[model samples]
Target: MRRLLGRRDFRTIFIALTVSMLAESVLVLALGVWVKDLTGSDGLAGATFLALSAPMLVAPLAGWVVDRIPRRAIFVALNVVTAGLLLPLLTVRHAADLWIVYTVAVGYGLSYIVLGATVSALVPELVPADLLPDANSALQTVKQALRLLGPLIGAGLFSLLGGAKLALACAVCFLVAGVMGTLLRSGRQAVRMPTTSDRPTWSSEVSAGLRHLVREPALRTVAVCSALSMIGLGVGESLYFAYVDQGLGRDAAFLGILVSAQGVGGVAGGVASALVVRRLGEVGAVAVGIGLFALGSLALVQPALWLALPASVLIGMGLPVSMVGTNTLLQRRTPAHLLGRAATALDALVSGPQALAIGLGAVLVGVVDYRLLFGAIGVAMAFVGGTLWFARRVAQPAVSTEPAPAQADFPG
Candidate 1:
């Protein structure tokens, strides 16, 4: 970990990403809260997240753009542009100006996809393969840690000052992140240019990432298991509210305590993720993460506060461990030119279904018993974890035929 952080480029990227994500964490909750305050409508407030996530439907396009640009340049540009985009929110004083908030939310979503793809592609250039897990872990840890404080800070600021002031603060964070991005001394490789005869069709170009994900055995396992796990996650998203209100006999405020507990666990998980990957291998680490998440789900079935708190912690711990393994594996296996596409492809596969499941769970929670739902989610996640563990035994190692980039050191 120390050695990985010693690299100047990686350190710079780390700080930049941390600052950027802090802004993201702060703004996301504030956006929803601001909308709720403006309209006094829960449905409209909920729509804020929909606006933020809707751009994911265009992730393929975003990924294609990421691949076409110099990643470092795009990373810096996106931060500056995102800061400018947030300035519109300052004008959102009335319900009539709600469009500004939603528009900016869409911009936020697009920036997230582009920046995420850029970073996934850029990180390999900044770190050695042997240190990839550590680098990813460090980044994930800081991001997770911010979840514990960023929202609280944003909420407090919004309450003390105003939504416009909060927006300005978040914009400043992005600008600072852009400054950090300028300090990156590496990841400046030339973009890949296809020859006329070898040029891909638009459809093929867009689907390239998905095709590669299906073709690669390790990535395939990770994608499949991760998608399966998302089913549980999506269902849990809606059902958790019910679990707290009815199952635990608690008010909505208590939900914050559970989330805080999860954040603490997430911090610990991020800190330990590199070691988990080192000992278990990427596939094994993901399996364990999913399994732990399943255990957390099962604990929720008991409805006791004691079980719920610990369960939230376990659930929190599982996500970072699995994500670190997934990111490290993707970086190690993907070709430089395809990294952006591959990363977005995986994001779409996992997040799309999770979004749908949130809707489905919202419907099901109304008609079905919460305990039955929790149990089913846990069992399904456990099955997915077990499937990955078994599949790892026979999975073939990744062997890319594409020539390596001259500047980047991608591991086989």
Candidate 2:
């Protein structure tokens, strides 16, 4: 752990990523509050998520551009531009105008989409291939931990100074991230940049990514499981509030506890995954991780908050494990030239289908009881896990490639 923390490159990006996450968290919590204030409806606040969901639909296109371009330049520009883009809110009141919010959402979500791809693709270049899982676990530990904190901070900030303040804070985080990207340098292109012309067709560029995905069985399996997980996430988002409020009758404080528990669990999970990666290699680690987390979703079943402790921890452990695995796989298999593109596609799968899943989940919330929804999604994820687990056995994929130093001897 100490060795991992000492990495300059990872540390810099980690700070930048954490700051950015903090900003986004504030923006989201603030947005929900603003939307609620505007519409006087909790449902409308939920719809604010729809704004976040929109850009995800085009996540593939974003990924294609990410793949072809100099990822560093693109990411830096995006973050810097986002900082400035958010400046308009410093004075605006009457934020209820749906149009203004919608516009902001589009830009915000789009920037996030590309920035995420850049970060994911950049990781392998920053650290050794063998260190990928350790690096990933460390990174995720930062992201998940900060996310849990971001929402609460957002709410507190909103209480003190409202939307403009929240936006300003977010802008600052983006600005800082941009600065980090601009100042930092990579050693050498571990992978070469793919050749492209000034007049390339968008459809063709996207097709390259799609084809790459289609060709790689490992990538396909990973994508399938990831997509399903996103769907499950969408459903959770749509119904979790109600489940907490209406089903379990938990208070805001209790809800916070559950959320915090999830993060804490995730952090522990990340730590454990580092050890697991040391043993299982990257692919096997992820296979185990996803299954564990997929199985972890069982937390939704236990109604009592006390039951949530172990449930959330088990579920959290699965997340970083799966995420680190998938990301490491992509980093190892993908050429530097297409790393951004492939990563972008992965980003799209993470965010795009998730948006749809959230929408479907939202719709389902209106139609079914919360328990039924939880049970149904849980079963669905379990099925997805079974399919993936079996695929791993059949594919008989080669021994895990270590993303970290000690990872080479997997299944040890």
TM-score against native, each model: 0.95, 0.84
The predictions' CA RMSDs to the true structure, in order, are 3.0, 4.6
Relative to the true structure, candidate 2 reaches a TM of 0.84
Worst 10 residues of 2 by lDDT: 403-412
Question: Candidate 1, which ten residues in sequence have the lowest lDDT sum?
Answer: 403-412
Off by over 4 Å in 2: 95-98, 187-201, 236-253, 362-373, 393-412
lDDT string, candidate 1, 106-213, tens digits: 999999999999998898877767777898899889988998888898899889878998999899989999988989877776888889999989989988999989
Give per-residue lDDT, candidate 2, residue 220: 79
Give the clashing pairs for model 1.
Answer: none
- Compute the lDDT for candidate 1: 0.88
Question: In model 2, what are the clashing residue pairs, if there are any?
Answer: 67-341, 129-403, 130-403, 130-404, 131-403, 131-404, 132-403, 132-404
